[model samples]
Target: MSGRKYVTTVGVEVHVELATRTKMFCSCLNAPQGVAPNLATCPVCLGLPGSLPVINREAVRLGIVAALALNCAVNPRIWFERKNYVYPDLVKGYQISQIAMPLGERGWLAIIGDDGAEKKVAINRVHLEEDTARLAHSGDNSLIDVNRSGAPLMEIVTDAVLRSGREAEEYVRKLRAILVYNGVSRCRIQRGEMRVEANVSIAPEGAKELGVRSEIKNQAGFNHMRSAVEYEVRRQAGALDAGGTLRQETRGWDDVNQRTFVQRSKEDAHDYRYFPEPDLPPLNIDPAWVAAVEAALPTGYEDYVAGLLGQGLTAADVDALSRNDALGFLRLAASAMGDKTVLFAKRLIKDVFALANSTGVPLDESRLGPSAFRDAALLLENGKIAAEGFRTLLDVLYREGGEAERRAGENQLFVETDAGAVAEAISKVFAENPRLIEDFKNGKIAVRNALLGRTMKAVGKRADPRVVSGLLDQALQHQGRADHDRDTRLPRGKS
Candidate 1:
C-alpha cells in the first residue's frame, strides 16, 4: 500500500458512426433517418449465405479524414479483418473491422482544463469497423432492425492520460467537436450516434503499480461519465482504506438510480477469441487516394483558431470567438468590409454578439447582416452616429428592414439633436421647477440631478441624456454664480 492519498486515471473508447451514404461492407443507406425500419437492409447486411460484400468508398474517405482531423498518422496500406462474435445485434456471426493495421495510430485531441490551461489527450488508435443492427427491447421480447447493420463505425481508443473526471469530460467534448466539424460523424449523444465507454482505475499517490481497472460500460453522456468516474474513485478509495482488494469487473451506470451496479465480470482480451476473416481480400489503400482524401478534409475549429492567431487574434479573443459561432460571421463581415481583424473582433464582442445572445438567435439569423453590420460599424467608427442611435437602428432593422432600403431610411425614429429644441426644454424645466432651482442655488447637489430628470421626462429617452444633463448643469452653474454675485453686491437699502 502506498502512503499518498489518491490518483485516478481514465481512458475512453468512443464508437462513432460515420455519416456516409452507404454501409461499410454492403451498399445500403448507412443513415436510417426518415426511413422505415429494415427497409434499407440487404442480403449481405442480413448475413445471407453466398452474399459477397463491397466496401463503400465514401466511408473509407471519411475514416481517413477522421483520422487526419484527430492528428493521427494515416496508414496508406491497411487491411480489414473480421471480428468474430455472437450477439443478437450481429446478424452476421462476426463483424468486419480493421485489426492489425488500423487506418490511424497515435493521434491527440487538445482539451481545456478547469485551470484555464490546455492539455493534450493522446489517442492510441482509430480504426474502421462495421456496426451491427440494433435490437429494440420491449417488456417481453425484442425486435431486430437491420437498417443500421453494416453501417460504417469508427472506433477511437485513447491512452490513459486523463487524470480527473473533468478532464475525461473535456476530452470527450473536444473529440466530439472535431468529429462533427470534420463531417466524419454527427456525434449526437441524444441519438446515440456517438457512444463512449470508460476504463477507470485508481492508485495511491506514491504507488508505482496501478490498481485494478474496472470498465464502466455504455456511458450515455459527458456528465454521466464524470459522475461514474467520481463514484468509482470514492468506492476504490474507501475499499483501499479498509484494506479490501479491488476486483476487475464491468459496471453499468444506472442513471435513474444514480449509482453504478455490477453488470458482470470484466473480460480479458483473450476471452472473446478475436480472429481475422479470410473472406475479404487485403484492403490495399493507394497512397494517391489517401492524399486526395486528406486534401479535401475539413479544417477543424482548432485549425481555424490557429489560422486566426496567425492573422493576429489574441489568445483570449480566440477563445471567446471559438466559443461563439457568431465570431465566424463577424469574421466574414470584417473580411468583406476590409476592416482590421482586431477592430472587427472588438465590435463583435461589443455590440453584435451581445445583441444576438440577448435575443436567443444565431448571429446570421439576426437582423445584422454583413452589409448592415459593416455600415453600422462604420457609423460608430467615424462617430457619425451616436451609440444610442446605433442601438435604435438595430431595433428598427429587426422591426422594418423588409420595407426599408437601408438602416438610414429608418432614421426618422431617432430623436432630433437640435440645440434650440433642447434649450427650450431646459428653460421650461427651470421655469416650472422653482423650488428645485432654489435648492440648486442653495448649493444642494442633489437638486441638480432632480432638474436633469425633469428635463429628461419632458423630452424622451430617445434624447441623449448625457448632452441634456450637460446643458442643464451649465445652466444651473451660471444661475448659481449670477445669484451669488447679486447677493454679494446687494445694497443695504434693499434689505
Candidate 2:
C-alpha cells in the first residue's frame, strides 16, 4: 500500500424501453406501468405453446434511429436469437434477442473523460430485445406481473473505457439526452423505462491484464450507477492490495448502505446458450428504408447544442435545459418568440425551471404551456413588464392559466409608460443626489449607473427602462457641458 497506484475502469450496459405502441414481437399494448397485472399480456408474450412472434416494424425503425444516434454502423441484415436462462420473471425459458447479428455494431459515444478532455467510449453493440416481467417480492412469496413482458428493449453496451464515476455519469446523461431529444424514448429512469448495469474493475498501474470484474446490476439512476462503480472499484482495489485474488460475480447496490454486495457468479455469453431464433425470420433493411430512417433523424445532439451555443446560450444554460427536459419546450417557444429566443431561454431556465424544481412539480405538469410561455415571453421582450414583473406573470400563468397581459394588468406589474411621470421621477432623483451629480461633473462618469438606479427606484420600478435611460443621459450631458462652460469662463482659482 506504499504509494501504489491502481487504475479503475468501467463498462456500462444500458437498456431503454422503446416508445412503440405495441410490444416487440406482438400486438399487445406497450404500457406496463399503471396497468393491471398481466392485462397487457398475449399468447406470444406469455410464451404459450405454438404462439409465433412477429417483429414490430415500428420497434425496428426506432432501433435504427437509436443506432444512428450512437454513431453506429447499421447492419444490413439482422436476426434474433434465443438466449436461454432460467428465471421466474423470464416466462419464456429462452428470451428472444439479437446476438449473432444485431441491428448495429461498433458504435462510439463521445464524452468528457476524467482528464477533462473529449474522449470516445467504444460501444460494443446496440441491439433490440424483449423485456422480462416485473417481479415484486413480499415476506416469503414473489409476484410476477407480465405487463412489461415482450416490450421492445434496446441495449447499448460500452467497452471498458471509463476511468471514473464522473465519466460514466456524463456518458449516461448525454446518451439519455440524445434519445429523449430525438423522441426515441422517454428514458424515465425512476419508472424503469431505462435501466443501467455497470461492470467495474481495478488493477495496479502497468498490470498486464484487467483484474477480475464485478457486474453491478440495475442501478436505479445515473448517480446510483456512478456510486456503484466507484464503490466496486475501491473494493476490488483493496482486495488486490491485500494479496487477495478477485472473483468474477454479479452484484447489487444497497442504496441505503451505499455499497455493493455480491449476488452470484456472473454468467458469460456461453452460459446463455444463444442460438438463432427459429420462429422469427431474419430482416433485411433495404436502402430505401435506411434512407427513410436517416431522413427521419433530427439534428444530432452535438449539432443542436452547438447551434444553441452560437445563439448566445452558455454551455451551462444548455446543460440545465437538458437536465430539466425543457429543451423541447424551448424549441417550441423559441420558434414562436423569434429573435428573443435567448432571452426566453434564460427566463425559462432561471425563473420557471427553478420554480418547478423548488415546488416538486415537473415542467410538463405546470399550467404554462408553450403558447402561454410565448405570451409571457412577449410581454417581457416588448418591455411591457420588468424582470420582476415577468416573474410574477409567470407565477400566475403557472398556477392559473390566463393571458400574460391580463395577469400583468391585474397585478399592476407592467412598467409605467407615461413620459410626464418618468420625467418627474428623474427630476426627483437628480434633486435628491446632488453629491452624485457633482461627482459625475468631476469626470466620475461611471456614477451614471448609480444615478440610473436611483431614477428607476424613484418610479417604483415601474418606469420604462429606455425612457429612464434616455432622460438621464440627456440631463447628464447638459450638466457635463455646463460644467465645462463654467470652468472655461472663470479660471478655476480666480473664480
Best by TM-score: 2
Candidate with best lDDT: 2
Q: What does candidate 2 score on TM?
A: 0.75
Model 2: colliding residue pairs: 416-462
lDDT of 2 by residue, 1-495 (tens): 546799888898999999899999999999754679999998999999999999999999999998988989999999999999999999988789989898989999998888878999999899999999999999999999999999999999998989988899999998898888776788888879899998888888999898788999999888899899888888887787787898899999999999999899999999999999999888998768978899967667787778789888999999889988777677777763345778878888889987797777777668887778888888878898877678878888888777777888888988888878878887888899999988777667788999999888888646678878998898888777787787753212211
For model 1, how does the per-residue alpha-carbon lDDT over 1-495 read when each residue is reduced to its tens digit? Answer: 345498798889999999888888887888766899989988988889999888788888888888888889888677787777678998888888877889899988889865679887899999988888889999999999888889999999999878878899889877876776566776767667898888889998888987898889878889999999888888888888888998899998988878788888887866656666566776777888878887865446676666667777689886666455444455455653233666777767767667767777645455566566666666655545556666767656544443223554457434457767778899999999898887666556777778888897777545666678778878877887787688863212211
Model 2, residue 324: C-alpha shift (Å): 0.8
TM-scores, in order shown? 0.65, 0.75
Off by over 4 Å in 1: 1-4, 113-117, 306-495
